[model samples]
Target: MKRAGTHRSDSERIDLTVRDYGLDGGIASAHTVRKRRIRRQTRFLAGLAILLVLTAGGIWLIKSLSGNTAPTTESSQPTTRPSATTAATVTPHPTSTPVPTPVPTTTKPQLSAEERQSLLQQAGDEVVHYLDQVTTGRIGIYFQNLVNGESWAHNDKMPFVAASSIKLGINTYLYSRVAAGEISLDEVLRYDNRAYPTGDYEAGTGTVQNLPNGTELSVRETSKLAITISDNCATNMIIRRLGGIDAINPWLNKISGIVDYRQKVSYTNYAGQSQNGRHRTCARDLGLQAVRLFSLWQENPQVYAPLIEDLSHTEFDFGIKQGLPEDLVVAHKIGTNGAYATENDLGIVFAEEPFVLCVLTEMASAERARKIQTDIAAIFYEKVASWPWP
Candidate 1:
């Protein structure tokens, strides 16, 4: 029985050993399967890492290439306007251009003789028409061609009071006296108290100054005063000094280019009378006086040069000067009275071709007459100066 028992133990031991071995085999197989799976998984992870590296490298290369091709894309994209400017360098753009301005010219057409004459006649008729509107009495007007030595007068036959414009006639006579050496221009004379019977202190009447009862002035100065200011006292003095009334007759008759004469009244008798406003001449005669003065100024610029120069410095602009351009220099005489019927202006306008014009009017108001004369003179200036008259 012991032997049998021992053998059984050995068998049992053998079985146990087999069982242990089987268990070991089983654990070993599991370890082998697990190691194989781990190795496969490690291999797969390595391959995936390589693929990912390759993909990242490719993306970086592509970006670098794109950045090189388009310079602004790597940084921020450039603005649209800047992009347009850059594109313009590669491709030309269509653009609008600017235009320039034009200049002015000065050439004008020349007028013909018939055209000028017709213009003058039309201008004269217009002047006459204008004058008729301002005067109820008579509107006497005259014009002279100083260049051609011709004259025209409407109502030339009638005589109006010289008023103050006779100063021009007095000026001519005074100049004649000076030219003849009858009275020296530099000769001084005492003021006679009887000369200024109409009160000596009238404004714009020149230097007819009563001389404080004993003041003295030169004949030239007196003549200047007579003309420039129309001083009645100075005029009286000059008339007395000029060989009186009959003396001026020959001088008046001697006016050859145009002649309109009325009987000469002596200065002494004329002034002495209570009914005397008698110093008289018409528009034609006054225009003649202007022509004569202009001719005198032209012929012998030295003879009456100072007087003409002085006359050009007219301060009384109410009559003819009112209508003329301020730039024009006019040598003129004006006449006015308290009575409205006689207001006149006679003047030589020194313009393109110097002209002689006379505007005489008889109306109810002296102011109205002066305005009429001014309007007429303006018309003459407008016509003669190559300006439109109407």
Candidate 2:
């Protein structure tokens, strides 16, 4: 009999007659064929199971390499399965990249030399035209635009009586001494009969003269009186303290554009005259002095602030200060000599665009000179108000 659960080829079936002859004419059984077909089916099912296992392993390897997790299925379980609760609660994160912030930029406009000169000339002509119509005095004016550094002048070389304006130079000398540590503001000086003689007592602009003869005032207080009130007695006291005109003139000469600065004022007179001669200054020099003082105010406010403060409180403002808006600040000095028929004002206008302006007049009455000064100042203010300030 043929073996059970065994398969045979077609050739073998064809040769079954020979085999049957050898087997003494035996025939194959149906039970043996059925058993052989069942065995083949079992082998095929095992091969399909192995193929599914290999495919699953390959998918898991690909997911791990790509930094991802393979999905779990209900029908198949991996070596380790995430808890159903953990997998269900997972939330996806956004992958958007961060952006950078932007920076701000600024733009500044520049002026040309030609344009600056043109503006300066136009302003100069306007000032000259207005001043010519107002007074018959010999006027000297110097103007400087603090912003653009443009300058204009009329009769700048001419010299006129310094009058009380010499107090500016006096105040500057005192401050210079203080800055050099040669003197102290707190140091006191006596207002005695020797310094202010009762016989030669000047009745001009200060209260210090009326005080008791031996009353003591600090260098600080004396300087304030000289500038704020245009006090002749206080000025003479400070001049005497500084060793008279000989000592102060050299300091004034060091300033640029200053041609003539001489004479010490007598207590009996507001005019800056002595045995030496009358003190003289020009518009150009006064304007430059104002510029220097402004620079000092900017560079060393603690040391120079009091001088500017006293100037701001100047009680005589019938000139430049009269023309400006009441809200504006002007650090200036005014000089008037009724005997000489001279009136002048020199100062820095602290406006939207700050500037230095000096107006000096000679051979004119006080009333006419002041009117001319006011008109000239008003014209400058108008021009500056129109300019585009930075």
Candidate 3:
């Protein structure tokens, strides 16, 4: 049995030991049984080791084929989303991000070119009808919508007596000077006989008017007086301050092509003699002045807005403001001469889209001129009121 155990085949030795060492064996048999028992234990242990090796290989092969090597342990659970990266221990993966839903919006109405033209033509027809009805004198009208820059005119290019309507030009130059820093609103001006002479600008007309003649007024105060009350003396002083009427014409020529009167023909320019045809303007010229003024203010509000603001509060609103709601802010200038029977109103009407309107009338009664202007303005305003235009 000893020779077969180690120096012989293991199966043969196990057989010999089991046969010789029966259940009732002697002391020698006991030793053989112990050896046999040890052999059985060794065989069982060997089988278990082989089975363990096979189980470990199977786990590795499954992990490789599935493209995952993370152990079934705490190391596999990540704290954050695993990135698409390979690591020495475990290869990681990326997860998808979700999308969100959107909301909607809105817009405004717009006018086509043909549609806008029709509206303008309708307004023009009404203007002509009203103008034809009144044959007492001549009437010229100008209108422009600031939004689309569309304009309509009737007898706009013909010359008309530029009554106080010329004041708009004079004051515009003053403001331009102020804008250039050549003049200041705060600077003091003399309303003396030199600028406002004895018969000039009605220095001799009223005691109240005469009182302020030799007195000093600020440039601001003078400008306000010129437009608000159509003060001739105040206008003369501004003309003087701006270095005479000749100095104002170059700027006027650029805007209107018509200049101020050369010789006085009426009481409006009581200070100077008026020239009728030689010093005349069309509705277009006056309308252009306000349009230019408005444009300049839009470009530089700090320097020129004061002119618009001052004109907005004029004391004389008879021609353009007649028959209109008091709430409509009309920044305008009016000139009327009973001798020439001329009534003129030129202004920037602050509508939803502010516009310029200049109406000049001659040889007509003041009452007639006023009615025509109001009616013409109403026609345009009616159309402008509904213009939430492009």
lDDT of 3 at 223: 83
All-Cα superposition RMSD per candidate? 24.5, 22.5, 20.8
Least accurate 10 contiguous residues by lDDT in model 2: 96-105
Tens-place lDDT digits, model 1, residues 1-390? 356444557778767655555444555755666787899999999999999999999999999999889855345755656666577777443221111111111223255556667767877788777755655555678877554433556776455666888778767877766777777888876666653333234343556654565468788887777777677777766766666655665677566313323454332111233232345667877777777777665656666776776566655677777777766667888887654356778887765556787877665677876787788777767776773223
The true-versus-predicted C-alpha distance at residue 123 of model 3, in Å, is: 0.5
lDDT of 3 at 7: 78
* Error at 325, model 3, angstroms: 3.2
| Candidate 2: tens digits of C-alpha lDDT, residues 330-350 | 788999877677798998787
**Pairing residues by index, what is the TM-score of model 2?**
0.66
Model 2 CA lDDT for position 390: 43
Q: What is the lDDT, from 0 to 100, of the residue 18 in candidate 1?
A: 59
Q: Report clashes for each candidate as comma-separated counts.
A: 0, 0, 9
Error of 1 at 168 (Å): 0.7
> Cα RMSD (Å) between model 3 and the true structure?
20.8
- List TM-score per model, in order: 0.62, 0.66, 0.65
